[model samples]
Target chain A: MKIPLPARFRTPVLLMAGLTLLVALATAIGSEQLNFTLTEMLIRMIVVIGLYMFVGNSGIMSFGHIGFMGIGAYVTAWATLAPEWKQVMLQGLPAFLQEHTYPFPVAVLASGLVAAGVALILGAAIMRLNGLAASIATFAFLAIVYSVYSNWESVTGGTSSVIGIPTVVGPWTAVAFACLAVVAAYAFQVSRYGLMLRASRDDEVAAQSSSVDIVRVRLVAFVCSAFLVGMGGALYAHFLGVLTTDAFYLALSFVTLSMLVVGGIGSLTGAVAGTLAVTLIVEILRACERGFALGGAQISLPRGSQEIGLGLALALVLIFRPAGISRSREL
Target chain B: MVDPLLRVPQPTAAELAAEGVSVRFQGLAALSEVNLTLLRGEIVGLIGPNGAGKTTLINCLTGFQRPTTGRVALAREDTAGWNPARFRKAGVARTFQAGRLFRDMTVAENVEVTGVGLGLDRKSAHSVAMEVLDWLGIADKAARTAGTLDYTDERRVGIARALVLPPAFILMDEPAAGMSDSEGEDLVGLVTSIPTKFGCGVLIIEHNMRVIMNVSHRLYVLDGGRTVAQGTPAEVQANPAVISAYLGADV
Candidate 1:
């Protein structure tokens, strides 16, 4: 009857600790290339977990969360870019923005805040719509973010990648944030608000009859998810040493989404597992494309095998286990 | 002039009243000028044949459907166009005609969410959830997925969810449909006990006359979207209009 807090968090905490340990071990024993791959994988895990926080809990498929990531990347770039570089590349930025630079942590936190602010504004209106209509509204949101950031010549460099972003993030940094995202996601799923949102997701009429404010609960999830996804974008910008709207657009969106579905769209464990599995598969296929030697003979996979293999694997997994590997089960 | 300042004492019990409530879809009338009242600690039954607008009446009372005419009042305040959540917060709760439990949640969670939604903290909500499940004799099924419950258990779970709110008024839509005779008797026991045990008024829309007659304190009969009769079961059974509505008038 007490609904003990620690007991509720056990699954998510264990999963987070387990992921962190796995990443640490990989960083220790694996080659530099593996560390790089693991870092990217961990970052993707954070983004997908952020996606799960909204999509899994609210039973709404959002195609626009990558837009939040885009917002985060630009905000981080705006905050951390050297003043000289900002003036030369981002001349469209106001003088105050172009003239100042903040610390890395401040830039990351600001990235999340800025993205959350945008999501709150959009979610206030978008959460009112349901079903495919809501999905379309989010898709429209993504399109708007893409177009604005792409064509905004002076501020975003007009389709050219913004360079000189310090590569400050590494494997451990990714692990830390991914762990934070997982904990935040777990905290949300086990909270009273999360339960209410899930109830609404299961049945709107019943939840409303129980006095759950569906719109408000959904907005909470949307904003929280955007905040984390925004942070993930910051991590990406620092890792890549460059910022591009294209990085957080359709390609990454589909990839993150596919990972979520493959891992199980219903649980936090699924988000991490799916990202790791998909990233590993992609790396293997890329290696195959690079002509790995086997049995003293050179074997070369056809180009674009990663895409074809990923698509085939996702199709097969869905066909066999429609709920994904975890089927909503927590770690 | 004498000072007019005075404070009125609170009403002893909550009351839900509908006056001349009517519902129309396009040009078709589903209910016309239907009036009903439910008071705390009372059990009332609304009975009718299929398509008698019984569900439509439930929808209007619970604020899912807004009547084109008339007012639905909570206590003395008119709440005609209030949303379902508003109705719930005002202490009105209802079970669906079919138990629409949160499919992904466990049975306990299904009940706990209602308590949480009604502003109970986690501990209190969990306590209420466990209490309701135990009261309904389905405590063992607390951790089972609500969607996997059998028909009878699902119905019990629905009642348990409604009870978790500590509601002042609960409207049940066809709670005994598809139930066996013994199950109907069990339901009669449950419905009869609700007003006294839970301290809430009940408005049950039931097609089965046996359950309705055995449990309800009063009965309102509807026919063709209009009230045909209202009285004690014996009185309504004897009324010719009520008889004609269920059977047919002499041709």
Candidate 2:
């Protein structure tokens, strides 16, 4: 039987079907914990896929992308916070920003746009660098952003958690955003610019001589990925109903990066798989720590078993399959 | 065979000239006072011993390197200090010494991407990729991943990539480097067709004397970052300075 969609789309369609099934099953069970876990997985998928859109195609690892998430979370908090709360909490805000509260969707969109704009400015400076230098530059950028957000007491909550963000991003909303992210990433990946960027990533000199415009392509990928990741950040803020700089700092960056690396640093399928696998492993390890019944006996792991076990599992996966579980193969 | 009144006149091909170009790395000069010219529809071979500044000169002409003391003029426009993409947009295409095809893409994509990068629409780029691959006689390998190609096919895809740009001037750097004698002969045949069939100028940097001598209309010999000889292949062959600088020791 002839399939209706073109062959190129089959893998992504299958992937989407699988993801939808996961969401459906989670929602149907009506387990709040399962729904929350699935929601967290979806948000991480958005961020990891967003990271993949740039790092996978451009062949440059960016530690600074989490900074965009931080920016997005803060922007959402700024826009969605009650005017009276904002006036008391963020006195450094300009009168206009302190006066109005926008819709959740608008806040999300605004945060994404703001992060993309910041990416544009940062990429102009950072994309000129290549390889390890560029990676370090991104780390520096992340550090700079973290330092500013950590100390900007009036504009941001500054080291304290910003509260009352309104938990509106349920599992369904998260899945919707994740689906949008997947489509956006797939669309960009197959676009002319994406092809050009990947070409440049594979062989820079050849790409440049072929007129691929390396810097421009890199900048475009950076901005687009930042915007998507920023949206993920907004979702996270609303999901948690609070925000802190630490949530978008090294812990989030490394966890997301580990997920990306474990899944397959080169493919979208890897991103989704890595996020799900890591999240499941973390949950299982946490359960183990809290004590579990096995063979009719109570078994308990150490308190830090989640972190140690996750690290050990990642190491074993890398040792067995250096390219990650996916090995760069896409759906 | 055709009516003279119906045939349109061909526009004269533009000239690409590098005048007194020099490249210095720190205190050492890679290319000093190197001068070369390639006219549209002309095949110019640049031959040199190892480290004779042949590739450096090519880099200068193609805008990959900035000449510290000279200029690259394309159709009378000074193109010195321009990036490689700008040079490509201005119709200067080049193949790398290594066949640096995008490993993940198929053979046809290597060509198609270049065409698209050069401003061809996707539909046209696809057709152009097919046409160019067919023209290069590598049409059968179009669906194969570029990284999996055998040596000769890699070279052909590299040439096909540059040709798809349909450039005004195409530079081939060591295209025949790793080929067998028969393969070199086949490449010579294929490269000889480039200028005439594609209606573009060619600057071929080859270590294979047989290919360079057989294919280029004129040959320029470089030694120690300076042009030692330039003339018809026969004329360049008989030049004593060229012979001593490159050929005498080997030949």
On lDDT, the leading prediction is 1
lDDT of 1 at A133: 92
TM-score of 2: 0.94
How would you encode candidate 1's per-residue C-alpha lDDT over B128-221 as one tens digit per residue? 7899899889999998999899989999999999887468888999887888988967876888888888889999988778778878888999
Note the DockQ of each predicted structure.
Answer: 0.78, 0.67
Per model, kept true contacts as a fraction are 0.88, 0.66
Q: Please, what is the whole-model Cα lDDT of each candidate in the order they appear?
A: 0.87, 0.87
Identify the leading candidate in terms of DockQ: 1
Model 2 bad stretches (over 4 Å): A1-4, A295-297, B1-13, B249-251
lDDT score at residue A189, model 2, on the 0-100 scale:
83
Please provide, for model 2 over A1-331, each residue's C-alpha lDDT reduced to its tens digit, 9 standing for 90 to 100. 1225667786577678888889999889999989888898899899999999999889899898899999998999999999999988899998777999899989999999999999999999989987789899999989988999999999998998899988999988998888888888888887888888889888999998888888888999999999999999999999999888888888889889989988988888888889988998989888889998889999999898887877887898889987788888776
The superposed Cα distance between candidate 1 and the true structure at residue A206, in angstroms, equals: 0.5
